[model samples]
Target chain A: MIKQILNDIDQNQAEIIAGLRKLIEMESSDGKATKAQEFVLKELKEMGFMTECFREDERSSSQVDYSPNRF
Target chain B: MNEVHLKWIIPPTDFEYHPEAYNVAGTIKGKGTVPSLMLFSHIDTEAENYFGKFENPYQSTIHDGKIIGLGASDDKGGVAMMLYAVKTLLKYVPQLPYDLCVMSILGKHGGGFGTLSALMKGYTGENSIYLHPAETGHGFAEIKNISLGVVDLDISVKGKPGKLHDDLSEGVNAAVLISYLVTYLEKYNQQMRDKNRFDFGSFKGEPSFILNVGTIEAKGGYGGINQRAKCCVRIRFYKPLTIEGVVEDLSKYLKECCEKEGKVNFADVIIERGSFRATPAQVETEDPFVQLIEKKITDVTGIHQFIHQYHGGSDIRLPMLYGKSHCVGIGPACALPQQNSGQMEWISIDDYINGVKILASILFEYCNFDQK
Candidate 1:
């Protein structure tokens, strides 16, 4: 049973690698990390995992930019 | 078939260094009579510019066999590895007895606010693995224990009113006195180093006790200068030492000095801040868990386990200090340059896979063993 699961993971290796690559490409910095984080949330949701995105202030969408100085 | 409920904890943005901070969480429920285990990693990294090494440090690159990026090693890699490990475990051991959780929390570097927040929200379990990069090298490196403590002290002295003159003895200089105190502290640090040179396998240094003056101030003009001056000092103590002992000893010495020289006066001292110490455990290297990991590594890479000590701090303290859980950090080695630039970092893909395998095996072993 474990071997079968390992085979399944191996078969999906490409997708997994692609997901990691996509996450890395998002360029998520400290304060300006929202867009990238949103991307991750979308990916998680697509992967059949329940996901939610929370804003620190809930009122300002622009404040999510990953910039240490702005925070 | 038991369905595992996985919840991703998205922490409030107000709690992060960036206006937008989050905690990513996923859970898998345990099978009959199995204990729950959490695998955690931090989603934050120290600013690239702190060490002034890279331009556009956030951009990740792949060169040779390495994944070069700001968090490729420090933690992002650990996060990725944990995610994959869970995926593999779920696929392979579908009905395992243990529950598993993976969290990429925020604010791990800035005093672990992310993990603390998660704990505050009541996310906990019996066993946990914090996926911070192992401090380089190969073999079985488990941080089963830690010495967590804080040092608090203020070094200050007063000088009589005076002006700059050729006769250096005429004016009592607070600045000079503070400078002397700084020198004494430096000497004390040297003494500590000489006494506790790094030995003990895998553990660094003989657990240090130190005094550092992070701030200084003085009152009254000296050397033809205007305005009264004062100084504030910061001290850090190593394991096996307490803040009370440090303060008491320093106070005693100060009193003795004042008695010898009636001119100098001691001011009120306070423990501006304090942090609790995480006690080290006496876990053996050949324990079942350790042996399990060793066998897994040998199976995968054909290399005997190499054990070493960590001379730094990490979120491992959270579970050890708060939850009393047996925790260890295992991950791929990061290729950090001699002088780190947030940009010039990397991890080997092969090592990353080995790390995942090792983590999965450890989890499986724990699941099979009953924690009474």
Candidate 2:
């Protein structure tokens, strides 16, 4: 069973490579994880995962750009 | 999002909170209402503000096959890959019998208050995964279930004030008393280090407990003898050692010092602030979660990832204790250069991308999406 699975993974190595490059290319850090999170939500929803995203309450947030920026 | 800042205190007070703090979470739903798999990453950088207006901290660039930026390796790498894994799994196999939730939390670097808030919002599961900054060679490393305990202590010493011209011996100087107290406490910590019997190895080869005097303040500088001196102390200890027990012992020690040293009152050594504690946690590798995760890691990476204790504490500890969850920390093999130095940090681009593939494979198998 493991051998079959490994073979299947080998066949789709290109997709995994491309997918990783795309993820690493997106830049989100600091209090800006929400930016990257929004991007994740889009991909998940596009791929049919029931998804929800929340921004920190502005009244409590310490950073400037806490609002969701849709792409 | 501006520059990085480090809060000496674990969870800063509301007044100290940055204006840009926020949290984001999403779920890949399962067939039933059973608690889903959980993944968490902190959003904030350590202290980028110290760097001033330099190049964009959020701008990520791939150089020499590495992703360089401020939060790239520390946590965003974890966040990016965790989310990407979910996307990949769903892309190849959409239906899942179990749910998976990914959270990019704020304030983890500060004091984990953002993750605390997320917990309040009900972000948890029976088994969870955490994204740590360091790498374990096995493609995935099962974090040691145990983390060290921490306590934030605020101590003040009071003594009789006297003028600089007055006899130094006659004056019950609070500064002098506090200094004496610090010396004694440091020696006590050293003694404990030498005699620590518990072999948890949280410190690897060193003692488990550490006492750090983070800050100190006196009413007057060295010029005059002040009546009061205050200091903030942080204590790190392993399990079976509670903060309350340490504070009790500390009070007794202070009282003894006062009696032996001068006319200063023992009651004057007040514990003004306390109650900040992060307790230690441990999970056995034989648990179902561990077995499943280990198998998945081996299947994906073709390597047996070792399950061992982690050195640092994280937000997952809270949920592990309260929610009765199994949380494992794993991440890309990337070096976090000057993580809080306000300098550019880096994560291996290949490692980051490969991590996604491994995690995706694990998710695909663990969630049994293909079985459906």
Candidate 3:
């Protein structure tokens, strides 16, 4: 039974690989202020998942950026 | 049919620097008797420069049975394997005994904001598998756990000006004086190394206490021009070495050195410290999860698995430290420790499939059969 299941997963591997390729093609970079977040949001929503977004406030941002002008 | 519900979290801009970073979570509810387990992997990858050779570093390519691409081995591979495992369990054995939560969080490389934010939103589970490279070929071995900590410090010193000509005793040269301090620290480092002082998993030696004099400045002199000198020092310490203890010891020695020189107006020495330690963890090599993974590998390719430790940090620390859960890292071997440079990085397709199978079997054994 486990072997059959493993085989089934193997059969579906191509689609999984394709999805991953699509995700990487988006070229998301950190702190770039790009649309990658929007892309992720749309992708998840289209896949029938609920989504939420959060951001750090001024106080928290300042605390996180604690290094003296060189972080 | 059993269904897995995935929750996609996208935080607002006010919560993080990269506000677009997202966490995709899917859950398979348990049948009442088993424990809940979370499988986590990051969705983000390191930034690439414009001059990078790869046309599209993110696009996956298969050449010579290796999956070549940015994020292919680092984490995207792990994410795909995790998602597939959960999906497989849901389809083939819907009534898993244990509750399962699979998540692909953001920022595994440097920005831990995604996982940190998720934790803030009250996402908790008892056990987790953090998927990163396990460097296949050494058999199926688990990371057992991780030691995540930080070391931050500053070291500075001041000295007076020396004579312009041949007056050997006029004053101390700030630059030269700072060099002496660096030499002293280096000597201490060598002693630590010789004594086998610091050891973290596979990485060993006392110089675990690393010192980097990142900055130095000096001004002021005796006769006409003023003279002074200062240096910024960074110290990295292994676990059990508190930052405060290191700073205090260095400060005491530095002050004594200044006093011995009889330099009243010498440069000021300043040192600061910061650190974080993840709780230690261990999983028996014979545990069901470990055994299941080993069985899958042997069955698939007739190779025995070996257990190993990771020398660096990973997102494994997040769950191990905060969730207080059992966490292990598993994946395919790409570049050897010292061989592959940046562009040459790649992972065999066979290894990738084998890793997925190992993860899938472990999930079924732990989340399905173990409880029964």
Task: Give the lDDT of residue B285 in candidate 1.
Answer: 50
lDDT accuracy of residue B288 in candidate 1: 52
Kindly list the per-residue Cα lDDT of model 1 for residues B165-265, writing each as its tens digit. Answer: 42345666666656655555566666655664434545555545445565676533343431234344444444344444444555555555545555454
Top model number, TM-score: 2
Provide all candidates' interface root-mean-square deviations.
8.7, 8.4, 6.2
Clashes of 1: 28
lDDT of 3 at B265: 26
Select the stronger candidate by DockQ from 1 and 3: 3
lDDT of 2 at B167: 45
lDDT of 2 by residue, B342-366 (tens): 4456777656665666666667667
Residues B1-372, candidate 3: write the lDDT tens digits.
001111112222332345454565555567756667877676666565532556666566778877777666656667766766666656677677776666666653233455545555655466677776764334244443443333344445544445563244875555566666666666655554464344533344324545666766655444433344556555544445443445555555655655676543223444432222122234444555555556666776666645545433355555655565655666666653224444634566677677777777777666544522
RMSD from true fold, candidate 3: 9.6
Those runs of model 3 whose alpha carbons end farther than 4 Å from true positions after fitting are A31-71, B1-17, B108-111, B134-144, B154-178, B193-239, B243-267, B273-307, B336-339, B368-372
Q: How does each model score on TM-score? A: 0.73, 0.77, 0.72
Q: Give the distance in Å from residue B312's predicted Cα in candidate 2 to where it truly belongs.
A: 4.3
Ranking by lDDT: 2, 3, 1
> Which structure among the candidates has the greatest DockQ?
3
Q: Compare candidates 1 and 2 on TM-score and give the better one.
A: 2
Answer with 1 or 3, whichever has the higher TM-score.
1
